[model samples]
Target: MSTQTTQTTQPMRTTQTWRLDQRIRVTGGEVAARVLGEGPPVVLVHGTPAWSYLWRDVAPLLARRHTVYVWDLLGFGDSRTDPGAAPSIARQARTLAELVAHWDLDAPALVGHDIGGGTVIRAHLVEHVPASHIALVDAAVLGPWNTPFTEHQQQHADVYRTMPPDIFGDLVAARFRTATHRALTPESAAAYLAPWAGSEGQRRWLDQVAAVSFEDTREAVARLGEISVPTLVLWGEQDQWIPLSTGERLAAAIPGARTATVPDAGHFVAEDNPADTAAALLRFLA
Candidate 1:
């Protein structure tokens, strides 16, 4: 495993500034990560088509009371983009476990969104990674998690893989728009889009989409009852991709799991309502 550090500034659209200044080599590839604040460790994992930038608003809030670590999953953000690297949920879970060991974190609280939800779950349950607490935000835990857009891209990978860069970027932006109840600021949109621009970015984006499979979640869902750590199932009341019902089911499956809902938010609850999301997390983590 190799490590690198680079100081780069992201365009400040909001008060939060996301800088992926640290890179750590993991099983799949080097993952870009940022560490901030000081206290108990809290790792924020982002979902599909998004990198650590997704936590720009929420990480700082959580960092105020906890040592927060945010990292881009392999093949996303500034991480190594080897087309051969498989960013499958199962592989991502293992990569996360590897990160936990590399950081020497003992049972850090985990917050995950979208496919990231699935990653944390699998890492804890299947990979036997320990965590003091787990929070699932609009997670893709239940099976049949694919949306029409993802299905289309999965079925027509070749077409999307070779689509014009401009068109592909627009498509990604449109997907991001749908993920939130409110529109993303131009700067926020650009930050999210930066990782998926150009030919290589387009192919890497499609590769992750194509790698999506229910089998990964199916394995974890079947073993949900085995989750011993305190769990929080949080959802966006307006989530269109994964309904609130899935979140409810997930909460029910985990023993003593608490539930929280962010109104007027879509799948990306952090982006939609970071305040409520952070508050719910703070309460649970405390």
Candidate 2:
């Protein structure tokens, strides 16, 4: 397969959002990432089952005033990873730290959603990367996050990987749909589905699903108060995956951390309410 894609570059804020058209070498695999605009640095990390594409709507807005970098975590998106490699959260955090150091970023501001939130938190508290500021949108910061389905997938990943292609696609589509309050448009659904449509893709997708663990968050939660950098805890008020209550508890744990609630949004706040999400981030960043 070709390493690059045929996508025409467009200006920020156009209907054609920026794409992750480049690959950066990382520890276990190459990560798909993109950089747009220029100024103070800001890195956007996406959570599991989603890629840097999740930031398409938000990155451009931030890029208007700051250099923005968005990347797919290992084992997701165009970032190819060895199926034999463990897809644990620590591995994801290590990859995030590697990318930040690879870019020679100096205390860049970080914005992360879902498991991406845990990755950045681990990068900051455990990996010792200095982030000027952090914004966690419905982050999985607290422990005991695995659902029954996820636990079963992890325990029987081999069996799950053998699912029929059509069945696998339907299952993922259904789960992705639940993350948003608004129904996913065909185009949006296709964008999220593109990375995990085929047999091999389905196997890797299961690997990621099975990789979700509480250990990473358990470690980060213990040190939440040590984060002295300015922080913002943004959440979708109607989040079903990680509740708004979790966001509130996280905000309370971090000293001087401010909270912003995005009304009418679900776990996928960027997809559901990018305007309010962007506005909250911009306010906190300022």
Candidate 3:
């Protein structure tokens, strides 16, 4: 089985590793998470094809001011998987609520990217989530939004059902760019793909990708009007996956919400524009 573990960085700097050292066992799986520091909780949820690791930089920065929680959704990161099954984002959202209750977080603020944004919204529908504010990073809220490459994305997700380990890694490395679509160092790129090693690992990505139904997601996106908390909309100006128009449409649908465009960042705004992402968040939360 192919397991992509971290490459040791030179142990000689003031910078510290955000060691992988936490877990939360929710229904359907035991999620791996990274938690550190302390204050009123801020939950950070990652997008598809990525795990808790994606929040490495953003989580720590937020942690300095609040108890930040970032975790892998079921079937992603080190979380368990069930082949041929793609758990709906609704289920993922429920699991998220359960996790929050387990942690005893009251009135926690939420920040989510991609589908994570949708999950946060849906969680609110379930009632009394202790949510103070909700933030979206290039959220896919304007639905019926199957971009030009949507079918192509589906085909690649389908291939995971049978691709060899090395081939799967190579394929993911090439296609992952489609998500972030930025210049990633070889090591940095590999670290993101490492969690999905081997057949079982490869299946996880496939299941989640296939689950991204445009019809269902559109219906959910339309429900944004139900959100009753303070909302912040942050989008990457260079994002190629979800259009800027979609972001604008989302800001309009959600009452009292506003949008900020990250000048240099793309879909992976947190990593590409960490400081700006943090600064905006700090202000929003404050």
Against the reference, the lDDT scores of all candidates come to 0.85, 0.83, 0.72
Which residue runs of candidate 1 sit more than 4 Å off their true CA positions?
1-16, 81-83
Over 182-212, each residue of candidate 2 has an lDDT whose tens digit, in order, gives 8988878888887888897797788788777
Pick the lDDT winner: 1
Order the candidate numbers by TM-score, best to worst.
1, 2, 3
Candidate 3, residue 147: lDDT = 49
User: What local lDDT does model 2 show for residue 182?
Assistant: 89
TM value for model 1 = 0.93
lDDT of 1 at 111: 86
Which pairs of residues collide in model 2?
Answer: none
What TM-score goes with each of the models? 0.93, 0.92, 0.86
Which residue pairs in candidate 3 collide? none
Q: lDDT of model 1 at residue 172?
A: 88
Minimum summed lDDT over a 10-residue window in model 2 is located at 6-15
